[model samples]
Target: MGKYIVIQGQNIYDVALHIYGAVEGVTDLLVNNESVSFDTDLKAGDELIYSDDYQINKEVTAYYKMHGITPASGEQHVYPKVFSLPKTVEIYTSAKEVGVEFSVSGNGKIELDWGDNSEVQTITLSDKITVFSHLFDSTIGNKRHVSMYMQGHINQLDISGLRPIELYILKSIPIERFVLNNATLSIDSLPMLETAFGVSLDGLKTNDLTPLLELKNLMSLSLTQTIYRQPTIDAYLIGLVRQHDNRRNCKVVMTARPSGEYREPTRDSNSHYRITSGMEAVWVLTHEPAWNEGGIWEFIINETTYKYEQNH
Candidate 1:
């Protein structure tokens, strides 16, 4: 990333919108400069390193060292900027045939390896998602590990009807937005390591969302219209996140409901912190009425308090 010297008084969100033309860019800023939080004030002349298309200038690296600021390693991004670098998702399916596809902006390309030793499918990406469906070849084993690589800087990746038993996204660069639908995958099987910034899950398997607490890099999550046919929310995940070190802002969207009547698990439960469900958390119960007609509930969690704003 290149360097930026703030010439005006601003905050993290302002700077992110200014630099990347999108407020969501704040995730990269936080990842790069851990010393700076979402609430950090950016005054004029404050030097900061950010993700960019340009190479890191050696002098900028030296300046960071002299200033005792260590840029956190790993993908750290934006344009309102396209995401370059290749982002990959591997799907392991028991289905007789495997099908998956996505689209990317710019002149980016997509490659799909059937893993059946057949010819790889490559396409120049377009506005519409390029789809690939392949029948399992018995000689190569019907069960396959199909892989898709997205090249270039596309913000969102959406794949539906991929009933993968196991799915994982491994990337050289972070894909800020992702959507998974019609899959048997569970959050527990995901690596969850800094791969995504915002994820929307719908029509997926696993109502047990306890594994969501393990997420490390996320600004937004959507569970609405998901596996939970019951108007239930996983308050346990929220309680644990509140207990953990995530004071920074995270937006969670789910169906309208309290945590439901199940025994909630927590660190205090002495179960090694494995997530449990039960009890209507204060926040959920308070906002339960907003989504009575099937709307979106956005949960905002900050340092001390948590709340939700609903759109009907």
Candidate 2:
């Protein structure tokens, strides 16, 4: 059988890269083929053919053929031991220069390109900060950056291949899926990334999301409110516990509001914990305070007083 080389879905540079490892390696051979250049990219179905002589052949072949270069008939052709660096990036631009794109859901896609051998990256911008810069072209003496930012609503950031260098969230928004490969996230622009996908506060700093619990979409919340004035604090805690006990699934952690008396909820075998009176602190921690079949309920008046209450 005659030995033939075939490369499918690659441009001249890519074929050359497969043959000699770099575009520079086959510059002399491919310079005669003016249709292809070093930077000229190829699609998924391009092909290059070589005859049994290991020389370039001008013939179109099937779509699903062998990729890269192959050996010639009698010559012991050795493929490149190494290859050029593959570009590491996938980017998307915004249509509305300052508006939302993929607000909540959908199979929508933006733009993607791995210009050269660059590091992976991910970036996010809030409404206030609405500009993303990138260096897509390297040969232009100076790096180039494209502008991508919207005004209202959360933009679905789509940079898959590049490692994350920086991420910025301008305003508070329910993050659907903000992935950063390996970079520090900048959230200084007014409560950025309040919740992940508008459901829970996962992958976010606790303090940054406290104020957003009031959002209607946030379900099953665990709120911890501290109270001072020991005597009054117990009442407050009890009231909150009673309110939250029957809710679906919620919790609250509390510490003294004004640094009076600091008391944490304690469990007692006999169901009686100590409480204190006025000018002290008390804790009334409750967890979904619905009616239970049988359980011990301890009530602390302040930090000295204690009450043994049974759950009905």
Candidate 3:
């Protein structure tokens, strides 16, 4: 069949005129290149077939071959398209749950490999926002390698899950928050908690402040409404606040109340004595000014010059 390579600003009609000297040849052109839309503008590298009896000119065929253009077989390969995932996917290995929210831009199927040597999970994607969850067994290692395949390309991520204390020698999981208010926190789990940006020990029952002291990156510690009422626990937690404040050079806000319906500890003279004694008796307490309105107080350590600020 005769073939013509469509160049810039050229259409089927133009190709017909150039090849057969008549616009009526466009019908033959369309019949041969049925894959092309009649109204669509021809791309610069489009190959238009004209007649089955007429052979493509040797020069034009060589030109197409040199440019790596192959004759279209009338079948087009369409791949699935995907949009960028909205947020970082966080999967809690301890809970064995995947929490992800994203949108698919094109038609395709998504395959998720949870890196546990298990069967791959697949889901169909419609052109809309999708929020889905997947539950699987906890991954074995410190770092979980999950692969997502869409179309023919693959996107992978090293999903960090809850790591055991034995894996502490390895890289720490990039966890931003650790919330175990009423749950029993083992000393071994302290290493995993070391990298948390925020740790909430609101209702912690353990008196072992040693584990919490290791969390040097803590930004906020909530002790306001918890079951911690022991004098020693209070003292140790105050010490933890001091150590965290001095080491991180970040103010640690400890929320407490003098009296409330909650059965938690009341910040009394005993708590004050523990705080002072824990700070080598060099700590000074200062209450916020009356204009502050809120009954806020500050405990300053003279040695490290760390302030344990408290807000009512």
lDDT of 1 by residue, 27-106 (tens): 77787887887556567788777888532234433444455543222122211323343547777776355444444433
lDDT of 3 by residue, 121-236 (tens): 56675544344444443222123444444442112111122221111222343444544444433334455446565555554454455566676665555543444444544465
The estimated TM-scores of all candidates read 0.47, 0.25, 0.32
lDDT of 2 by residue, 1-312 (tens): 131134444445445434443334345444444565455554445443432233232221111124323322121122222323222221233211221112222232222222322343333344332333444422211122232233334434333223232333334543444433222222233235444332321223222322232332322222223222444434434433334333222222233332334445454688644334211222443221332223323332223333223441
TM-score of 2: 0.25
Shift in Å, residue 232, candidate 1: 10
Model 3 misplaced regions, further than 4 Å? 1-171, 241-246, 249-312
Runs of candidate 2 with Cα error greater than 4 angstroms are 1-136, 139-165, 170-182, 189-312
Tell me the lDDT of model 3 at 43. 80
Give candidates' CA RMSD values in order. 20.9, 18.1, 20.1
Model 3 lDDT vs. the true structure? 0.43
The residue pairs in collision within model 3 are none
Indicate the residue-level lDDT of 130 in model 2: 31
TM-score of 1: 0.47
